[model samples]
Target: MAAKTNPGRFFEDYATGQVIHHAVPRTVKMGERALYHMLYPARHALYSSDQFAQACGLPFSPLDDMVAFHVVFGKTVPDVSLNAVANLGYAEGRWITPVWPGDTLRSVSEVIGTKQNSNGKTGVVWVRTRGLNQHDEVVLEYVRWVMVRKRDAGAEVAATVVPELAQVVPTKDLVIPKGLDFTNYDFTLAGEPHRWGDYEIGETIDHVDGVTVEEAEHMLATRLWQNTSKVHFDTSARPDGSRLIYGGHVISLARALSFNGLANAQMVVGLNAGAHANPCLAGDTVRAWSEVLDKAETAAPGVGAIRLRLVATKGGAPFALRDESGKYLPEVLLDLDYWALMPI
Candidate 1:
């Protein structure tokens, strides 16, 4: 008799254009938000206070954007990256709508491209995944590629066909949550007075705070999202005997640290691109900084979009991203480019 068990998909199992509907939709609530804040220093006013969100024109506070992302991404791990070597990168991501407490979130992914590595041991799979609300509304969507291991190391894969992806989501494509009017925005309460017009391209702001990653905190956050990546939970998976911190955790950490300078950079509307430049492990002190890339005016009244380059480092000098040869320094943990909304 065949033993009844489940072994997740391997690299050769994927075909370009294949659609995968992930299982187990999650109904997010304030408890997840509370735990997220407890894990990271996430204190954006719009996500923290109903009164503040209402003043900015939302009926009530919404779940933190990163929290929603984690829930959606978590659902796809089993089906997509269960045997992955690495989560490579993200691109062309946008937050379509706000996710509130009690919103049931689900994820669907389509394999857009595949390319086998020369080593014959691994291949890259690119999936465009979306998080949908209960009503079938797309709350968020993005393209991410993962390096996956092959069950048969010498297995042949389809010819390399990497899909063409955008480097930056155009500003016009940035979605504003319904009824979100920042015209009457209260800068006093939002924690910073910098509006969209205040920032200049090439300006850099060093977020002068750091958080030491703790083992328990990362474990709790990873488990909360139901993420079962071995590198994040099993120290035995790596040679150094340290569980690698989830990349999304570092994203939230850097975003939270940006509050010191970008407190009013309210809602994250678009994720243009991101990279986990290096692995983060517990005991590393993470710090952040941001550079103004560009700005654009949106049709929404009193709302504008600002493009930013956010960098996270573990004990590296601020504004230092690359070494002499332009390779990312070992101390650089993340490099993210995104669009955020702010009052005009």
Candidate 2:
């Protein structure tokens, strides 16, 4: 008799240019939005109120951008990172289309590059993943690399292939949702007086809020997205016996905290890069801050794009990201570069 359960794909299983269609298409409903807000302190007006969104030219409130990202990303975990040591980094991420409630989403990944690690016990795999709605329109896409364990340490694999990725998603390439007009955007209702022009390049904002991670919440968040990563769920997966908090958990927490000072930066449109600097565990109080990287004007009426560096730290002085040597500090949990839509 043969084993029926899947052992998951190992390092040697991937090949450059290989296409993998992930399983389980999820139908996102208003319940997901409610649960997401329940899990994190999400307060972006456009996602929180239908009237607010309609006033900005959208039909109604769409799901939060991170909600679409996590659902899509979770669908790929079983195939891409079930045996992964760590999710290395992300680049060239973009939210191509808005995900409304009741939209069914699915994911597909293409292996763009692979490199065998020096230790032979593990290797790195780079893949480009896309999330599509039931209409078959792509809603989100990104490039991410993960270090995965080898099934057989002695097996020889192909030569290393690394794909060249964009350091920044060019502003011109950003897709503003059709009919999104911020001309009538209300600053009072949005909960901030700042507009796009109010922010200057190189400005840093300390969002003074913190959330102590709970084991039950983190586990629930991971399961909500259907992510089956062992490290996030099973303590035995890590030698330290601590269940690792999903990096996306930190990303959402930090984004939610940013609302204190960035309440007007509405929609997340682009993800240039991200790094999970250190593992976050239960009992760690997470804090966040953001730095204005750049600003650009869009063709949309009263619309603008702002590039920001959002950083999450467990416990550290605000604005302190790296050491003199350029390595991430021990307290840093996540460093994310992204672009958002704001009224000009």
Query: Per-residue lDDT tens digits of candidate 1, residues 96-117?
Result: 9899999999999999999999
**Candidate 1 Cα errors over 4 Å, as ranges:** none
List candidate 2 stretches off by more than 4 Å.
Answer: none
- What TM-score, computed on C-alpha atoms, does each candidate reach? 0.98, 0.99
Score candidate 1 by lDDT: 0.93
lDDT of 2 by residue, 184-240 (tens): 999999999999999999999999999999999999999999999999989999999
The numbered model that scores best in lDDT is: 2
